[model samples]
Target: MKAARFHAARDIRVEDVPAPGAPGPTQVLVKNQFCGICGTDLHEYLGGPIFIPTAPHSYTGGQVPQILGHEYSGVVEAVGSQVTSVKPGDRVSIQPMVSPRDDYYGRRGQYQLSEQLAIIGLSHPWGGMAEYSLVEDYNAIPMPDDLSTEHAALIEPTAVTVYATHRGGVKPGDSVLVAGAGPIGQLQVMAARAAGATRIFLVDLNDNRLEMAHRLVEGLITLNPGSTDVLREVRARTAGGVGVDVAFECVGAEAPLGLCLEAVRRQGVVVQVGMQGKPPALDGFTLTYKDVDLRGSWCYSTLMWPQVAALIASGQLPAEKVVTRHIALDDVVEQGFEALLDKAGTQLKILIEL
Candidate 1:
């Protein structure tokens, strides 16, 4: 099988590797159809060891030369003896997360928060950027025939945004602001609107992404904080100079994350959706005076995948709109990863079609 493996920073290779062996009693073998290159993958390719283990990971026990994809979809090629939920020929999306069953967080039903957490692609032997993958049965979520494999590849990231919106408590008629117009930020806009937020603002320094966000999301207002005063603009558009009801920081930077503190109305909520490279400073005065509720959202609950998949199936999520480019497995390093680093900021989601 041909797979893209990460050996070190700036070194991803497409090489012929051993295919994942037959499934274990509670496992399934998935033949890759479509795999999306995510921001986390970029981090690993650019400067990492962030999630890719330097030493062996405790949970998955996977080490370096790790496979490098997680947001993906495939067909069930085979199932293990104990697998009953899905069978051969079933199309599915992967949840990707893995953790030890006996871990404290796992026992509490918060497996994503487990200290020994290891994602399938980043820590396990098989990932979607390959010809085949071996995953636990619980990680495979069946997809309806009506759903395209392209859309199925987006379920993982979409689930993240759905969880973020839920965490922020977006309600009907609320005004929302997303402080980043990257792929996740765009999805945050849609998720907030789906949660019944009436007015949505997408803030970014890149004009290309802002334009794409405006086009992809209905009734979205774009702001370039680089040129415009984002805080003033948001307050002017919202009620009582109070600003948006909920603000999502999706850039994972100090500037954008800081904007969330100033952009939300008094008593409003701010959800941190993006993973920051370093700890961002918080404004104590703004947090104290406005009584703003700040919340951190990690990955989604195991139960959130079904809801996200249903949203994609229902045509409400418009996940396909976020796809800016598609490349073959062989071109993943150049066309897929490098293109996203283009200064134009034109690319959003880049999918590798296997």
Candidate 2:
């Protein structure tokens, strides 16, 4: 089997590797079809070993020189003896979060909040970038026959956006302000719309990404902080100049977080969706004065697979609209990663077609 393994920063190699032959008692062997290169993968490529462990991880025990990919879809080549959820020849979307042991959070049905959470591609031995990979039978959620494999691969990231909406408590006729136009930000817009948000506002420095978001999502208002006063504009356009009902900081930066805090109405909710590189400086005054609720949204719930898959399959959330390009596994580094990192910000989601 050919796999792309991360050796170090700027060093991802595509070489032949030993195949994951068979499944364990509760495992499933999947023939990977499509995989999406995530922002986490790019962070690892640039300056990492962040999530990719240098030493043995506390949970999965995976280390550096790891296979990189989590957003992917495939067909089940084989299933283990105890696996009854899926069988051979079933098309599935891989829910990569692995909580090998029961914990307080897991006991509460919040597996993603478990302290020893391990992701499939980042910390687990097998990943979807390869032709074949082994996963727990529970990780493989069977897909609907009408869903395309490309769309199936998107279920993972869509889960993130959907969970963010849930975390923000976005309701029908609510107004939403998303402070980023990246891939996740674009998906945030779609998720907000599907959650029945009547008005959606997006802010980003990159005009290209803002244009892409406007084109992909209907009735989206885009704002570039570089040219316009985002806070004033957002407040003016919102109901009674109070501000949006909910605001999401998707850029993971100090400025965007500040924007979200100030743009949201008093007593409104603000969900932090992006992974911040460092602890951002907080405006305690605004938080205290407005009585705003600031919350952090991590990964999706372990049980969100079925609901997310249904949303994408039904076209309520057009996950495919964010896909800018698709390349083969061999071209992942140059065409996929490099293309995404381009300063022009033209690309969004780049899928690796196996």
Give the backbone clash total of model 2. 0
User: Which ten contiguous residues of candidate 2 have the minimum total lDDT?
Assistant: 210-219
lDDT of 2 by residue, 1-354 (tens): 999999899999998999987798999999999999999999999998789888878988878879889999999999999999999999999999988546898788888888898898999888889999899987999998889888999999999999999999999999999998888999999999999998999999999998888776678999999999988898888889999999999878888999999999999999999999999999999999999999999989879988998899898999999999989999999999999999899999999999
Considering summed lDDT, which 10 consecutive residues are worst modelled in model 1?
A: 210-219
Query: At residue 44, what lDDT does model 1 achieve?
Result: 92
Error of 1 at 302 (Å): 2.0
lDDT of 1 by residue, 147-172 (tens): 88889999999999999999999999
Clash pairs of candidate 2?
Answer: none
TM-score of 1: 0.98
